[model samples]
Target: MAMMPRMELRQGQSLVMTPQLLQAIKLLQLSHLELQNFVEGELERNPLLERDDAADVPPHANGGDGPLAADADSFARAESLNSQDGMETRLGTALDNVFQGEQPTVARLDTHGADSLPVIGGAYGGSGGSFEEGPEGFESSLTAEASLHDHLGAQLDLAITDLAERIIGQHLIDAVDDSGYLGEPVGEIAERLGITSARVERVLAVIQGFDPSGVAARDVCECLSIQLRDRNRFDPAMQALVSNLHLVAKRDFAALKRICGVDDEDIADMVAEIRRLDPKPGRAFGGSTAETVVPDVFIRAAPDGSWLVDLNPDTLPRVLINQTYHARVSRAARNDVEKAFIAECLQTANWLTRSLEQRARTILKVASEIVRQQDGFFAHGVEHLRPLNLKTVADAIGMHESTVSRVTSNKYLTCSRGVFEMKYFFSAAIAATGYGEAHSAEAVRFRIKQMIDDEKPAEVLSDDAIVSKLKDGGIDIARRTVAKYRESLRIPSSMERRREKVAMAAGGR
Candidate 1:
């Protein structure tokens, strides 16, 4: 082949991520506290960006609000929220105090059900101290509440035969979710906890009989069966119910009646009795209350029928280039290496300042679009959370989905209702039927939770029943899908729910 030297121009479309742009995108996903820490680090390394102590503070200046002083932590912030410098973290609120003195404690404490080990910030006067007041100047509705696993583990500690049994029980308790149900398979939990599955099953059997009754079972069926055994009223019909939990779950009344050798009337009685067991024995967990997310941005409704969207001032950090060192380095620089280093520092400092500005703009733009999309949620409540997606907000703000995704990832938006992660507002769309308008999946989930809560003990709604109820409100969901949503919400199946009721009744009696 002969090579011909020719100059031609062609055009094509392509996407490339520049190093700086990637950095910017990475910064976007960081929570308020994370970004603040990042900027503080940048200030130490770069001599240009300076944090002001006594001057007019910039809109999002670090340490601007003077942070919650260590001593005033009890007076100022809630245990579930912590303010360092000027940044606040809802999940990691007590970090500063965890490492305040010569003794260093891990800032983030384990939220798992491991008792005996006090919860994170437990010693800082969290449960019974002045710290209960929450952060000063900021209001949070979520009170610290005890978790389900903790309750189960506490009971296990008292009930188990030995240390190994207790250890196994703790492993099982750890496997349970927030609602106190074992979402993980017993086999999987055994492998993870480095115990034999047999040990897990044995200890789990013991745990199920522990106080609160329905704990440590892999599925709702087992949970109920264990509770039933504890009741010492197990019958062939009841035994058949637990053994064929899947059939009972499907409402296969014909088959269940045949298997239990019962008629329609007896079927109703058996089902009712089965329904009276406890599924999540750990749900009665006691300790802290009021767990909630704190938003990074606050949109204040002005008296003038307008809005003032601002970053939570509590998250503003006090960080910047040390003014004295910066001035000294600039004046006394003489060597080539020194000048080059200073030049690099200057570039880094400028980039950091610009990055901070861009960070605020991006967050504000995203949050504003969220407010626009979820105006109903703000005005009404969570039920009004519109069906939204990352692309929806990105398109409205003239950005990319990835950009919006990163922005909403760790960011929180605080409003009059409460603090929620930025992503909570965006939900999958549930197509509307002939009944009414389409709804957001989150709204549906919330509704499902509510419906389950309000159901009369004598009449727990099944998936089909739930579907009918949702249809009345305009949503067309299937029973299986409803069951899926229920599971996702860490809710019990109908049988497990009935069992829980029975256990609760027995306890009450």
Candidate 2:
């Protein structure tokens, strides 16, 4: 064959990933907060995109059944019901009647066993007020907490008098980490400041004695020692225990007893006292605020024993393209450059709105299928969680495994049991004995935890024993697999557990 410059036209098929399609895929995997941020950025950048405030508009004004209207209807009905004589008795009777019906409606039970009124709309169904409505209120107005550095600076200003000593103290405070451990060595600080090591040590000692007792200590053991010295309880036995934290971590109570030169009761007392001390003193002062996990989907038990899945409307980004604005701008454009800019903005805005809508629908579809597949889990508990995987869900919903994986990522579902990440429903399958059905790895882990929790101090279950118990229950799992699961659950080995139980018994006595 000779190499030649030639143009050959061939017909073929390929899936082209357009920019809009890529954007949709990217939006699918983002958590609610991330999606909100992305949308907010788009709103600022694009001229034709605006937030959908239709939710806040009254239903009567919009001439549609919106959230506000539904909420008003529900409140009206509640008031009317309340106005009747013997309303409390009638309400209880009405609930009883509703509970006996075959149709499933969203209902909850109070501590008194009476059926709580169903929530009317927004995420589940109908028109109702959204959780996103109203001002952020007092929480938004509250100031950020003082950082660890600021807190220490305030204390340092009050405690130190001399200029040279105050400068050293501030430098030492700067070296202290968020965990309240001194990051720099005394020799290093001394060398850096052209000061004597002894002077640095003295200043550090005074600063350590400042509020948050152990703020300037070098290590965990030193931190504990500082707190103990402040309490005037740094006795020899307690000192020994603090020095040998590795043994404490291993639950080697017998070794602790020997090292501390104390009886079981005294060692236990010292351990308890150490536990009462603040380990991360600086965390209480200036750690970053924990971000709340807002679930994208909700799973509720219907009255008919089926799980009802709904997308959180509050989490769903509501965006609309300003078609009127786009039309007006396009008409005002005099040149191709101006016309192109207007058209591009309109296209981008349209894609974003469609992407958001598709993202919500896909999330709802995936979540609903998950609830259907793991119906046993929601009905019962973790023990009943079916063996599931991304492929299983993908195949069931007629989507690719990668698409399913992306949908599940960073998304959470709120249910009666608790809020769990969407990925939690999918676990590797564990084989079963004989001709029995496969078990979920998660369900197996739950079983092992239950067996260990129920085990008496006198009868601690080993890995082999757990394997035997699971085998008897029709789950064909290995001892090593059980051990892996046990370790993953942060459970100690049988020996460690037995030692802890024995220590607890001795301490109680």
Candidate 3:
């Protein structure tokens, strides 16, 4: 009986994830910025989808009998009808109800926290609205230029004779990373790109001459020398120091002195001058800043001294399915198959909308938990950063650990201090209160910052010394651990601290 083949004809049912459903589920977990980018990409690929670009377009731009509805959309959006396209060229609003009935006005994110706010991701906490407008007399502008690549392109256009050279130049420029070092050797690049080493060097030489000098160098010393040579200040002595960078880093002042054939005093002065040189000169001029991230959440100080937490409106993508287009697509359908295809498209459109709403709910939920757990941070500052883990947030948000990890990773929170990754707020639990609930690493970092700030500059505290102070304040931490934390905070060692202090003292005197 156990070996008999099954011949049952009984019907069974189970939920199977369709391709569309899978896509929807995947979309649900994306953070605010990712969701925005996803929607933008879809708008480009799908003719039936678009962002609410009404604010940017002028009325009467579309024209004639079907006169551009763009202008009217802009006016309407100005009146708070935040919309995707024009009113006349209406995107398919799933009609006969609510979203259509309440047709959204182009509501600008309230920089001053307006009455009602659109919902964003769980990356932002609370039901509050974000108020991000620069205050009176405040002008907002990012001074950073396009990038090293773009700058090189502009220069190449003016400098290069052949198109091939320009193409080769761009690849080389791109090869240079954020650190301004072309880590790949010119010969290796030549072999990989099927170009000659001499050609690569020539192109790189041109790139190095671009505004942020020394941009295309293969090494840090070479990068600095490129700048120095360009300025015509790279004398024999300076050249020796730049080339023997290893010795300089080893703090071998004597070796540097001997190499330059100068006294210790001259070496010290030369080293100081070299320190003033930009190691990553290319970055002195703005790069793509493509790595720039907009914080998913924003917290601002209220006049009453309370902090209001809200999501960045820009992060929440405003997407609408082209209802009118869908209708036309249906009308234009020639056969049953075509109609079915259109119907499927309609289904996907609806699923996208639902997924977006679900994303918003998840983001809001996560953000709310963060705000609750880190309330002390909003009120006090970084010192109040509680040592919270994914489990702590997951429990508070009623989600799984995996879900919390997704929400926190690559997400940002904007506060009065600065924009920080959400993950930055989550720290390992530190021992406090003898054996009770642990103190937040954030709290300890803040304490560390405070301790350093309060200490007299004449004597820099060592890591061991700092640990002793923390223990006295009821925090039980090891000396080496303090050193590790201090290092992470970019605090230098005791010797470096003394050097800086001495430098400052000499300058003041």
User: Against the hidden reference, what TM-scores do the models get?
Assistant: 0.54, 0.76, 0.69
**How many backbone collisions does model 3 have?**
27
Tens-digit lDDT string for candidate 1 (281-348): 66566633564455667766645434445555444444344557767887888999998887777666
Tens digits of lDDT, candidate 2, 203-307? 998899888888888889999998999899999989999999988977787899999899978887888898999888888886646688878877777665555
Clash counts per candidate, in order, are 28, 1, 27
lDDT of 3 by residue, 218-280 (tens): 878888898888878899999999889877665667678888999978887888878888887
lDDT of 3: 0.66
Task: Give the CA lDDT, 0 to 100, for residue 395 in model 1.
Answer: 77
The collision pairs in model 2 are 67-128
Model 1 accuracy (lDDT, Cα): 0.65
Per-residue lDDT, model 3, residue 405, is 80
**Shift of residue 81 alpha carbon in model 2, Å:** 75
By summed lDDT, the worst window of 10 consecutive residues in model 2 runs over 89-98
